[model samples]
Target: MFFASDNSGPVHPRIMEALMEANQGHAMAYGADALMDEVRARIRDIFEAPEAAVYLVATGTAANALALATLAQPWQTVFCSPVAHIHEDECNAPEFYTGGAKLTLVGDTDRISAEALRAAIEAEETRGVHGPQRGPVSLTSVTERGTVYGLDELRAVTAVARDYGLPVHLDGARFANALAALDCSPAEMTWKAGIDAVSFGGTKNGCMGVEAVIFFDPAHAWEFELRRKRGAHLFSKHRYLSAQMAGYLRDGLWLDMARQANANCARLVAGLRAAGMEFLHDPQANMAFPILPLRTHRRLHEAGAAYHLWNGTLDGDDPDQPIAARLVCDWSISSDEIDCFLNLLRA
Candidate 1:
């Protein structure tokens, strides 16, 4: 059983088949491919933003960094939660892409409150030109802690940003998973919630490596294109990227995959609860942070299950001591795997 990360899962067969089909014939380069046109049209229709500008990149980092760079200035600062992927996981890519802009972490928790965001923004620029000016506000839907921001929470944070006329960017690396968990429309979770742009994730769902950066207003389109190229994220073989996204959008495959993933996680969570495992955070989507006895951890590890240990170690002194683990479920993870993992934990 592999629960290390959604990124570790295999690409869907449909996506791979689409890639093979796309490779059969040569198409235009640099996002000029016919498939890219279809992908863009599909994304626009899905998001219900007829004027949205959508572009695909190979990595979530590129999607988020380039999108943020388009919305931020060099001397500005991006506000986000301390647990945001852009803050904790991106390793300064956002700062690099924004040309020295800083990240102002909003709150101590995974979910940033509207009051905290307002305070953070207000606290900035007090040093005049010597301090970083407030730039765009970035929100992660399925936050790093695996808890999702509800529709009201999302709107609250975005409303605070909008009050100051700052643009909002959503790091949607788990976009579909969050959408499925919340039962919200793409538009309702994003533009309708005051998000200016989104890093619409596909890699963690089922694509090999494709993420789309969607700008609602389209005014930032040219700037994003330039930033993408300058950041060395532009692919010469752009058709491959387009093909992955096209297949992801085709016939509602993206939603189906997300539903499967969330269902798998739900099953896992239910099983863990039955086994008396304590959760560090609520299992909102496809990711879970559960705390279990170290003996159970060793039992699973020795059984050839792979997952991340969030705290403590396998060889620690007390077998009964609790340790947290980060478990992720992808579309391909079956009910059998979840049951096997739970059985192993009980054993």
Candidate 2:
């Protein structure tokens, strides 16, 4: 049972077929391909933003970093959760890409509350030109803890940023998963709720390493294009990225995959619950964090079950010590695989 990460899943057949088709003949280079035009138009229709600016990159880091670099200045600080991917997992790419713009972590948890966000933003710029000025409020839906931000929760935090006239960015690495959980349209979850830019992800859901950076306001397009090119994220042969995204959006395959992954996660959560697993956060999308006993963890590890242990090592003395672990379900994981995991847990 492979529950290590959605990023470890295989690409969907449709996405692979799209890539094969894209390899048929010669095409233009560096975003000039016809496939890219279709991908852009499709995203605009999906998001209901006719005037939005769309660009593609191979990794979520590139998408987030380049987009943020375009939105934020070097002398500012971005507000985000303490466990946000941009802050914890990105190896300071956002900082480097934004030209030394630092992150001011808001709440201590993965989810940032509006009250905490307001306090964080207010706490910045207190010293005259000494402290970093508040730049953008970056929120991660389907937070790192396997929890999703409700629509109201998203709006509350975005509204706080609005109060201070700061822009908002969504680190939507799990954007499709969040949409499946929330059952909301792209517009409702984003621009309508005051999000300025989003890194619309596809790699984790079904595609073969492709993410789109979308700016609801088209004015940021030129600056972003320059930043992407400067950051070495601009692909010389960009049609492959275009094909993966096009296939992902084709016939709403992206949503279908997301729904399946979310359903798989729900099943996994139910099975974990039946096994008396204590959860760190409610499973909302394709991720779950459960506290497993050290003995149980050792058993699962030896049995070839793959997952990340979030807390404590298996070498500890106590066999019954609770150790948290992260389990992720991708669109490709079968129900049988999930059952196998639960069976192992029960054993």
- Candidate 1, residues 1-347, lDDT tens digits: the string is 89999999999999999999999878889999999999999999999999999999999998998999999999999999988888888999999999999999997998899999999999998999899998999998788888889999999989999899999999999999999989989999999999999999999999999999999998999998988888888899999999999999999999999999999999999999998888999989999989999988999999999999998889898999989999999999988889999988888
Pairs that clash in candidate 1: none
- Score candidate 1 by TM-score against the native: 0.99
Query: Can you give the TM-score per candidate against the true fold?
Result: 0.99, 0.99
What is the model-wide C-alpha lDDT for candidate 1? 0.93
| Model 1 weakest lDDT span, ten residues long | 139-148
lDDT tens readout by residue for model 2, 268-324? 999999888889888889999999999999999999999999988879999989999
> Against the hidden true structure, what lDDT does model 2 obtain?
0.93
Candidate 2: deviation at residue 155, Å? 1.1
- Which regions of candidate 1 are displaced past 4 Å? none
Q: Model 2, which residues run further than 4 Å from truth?
A: none
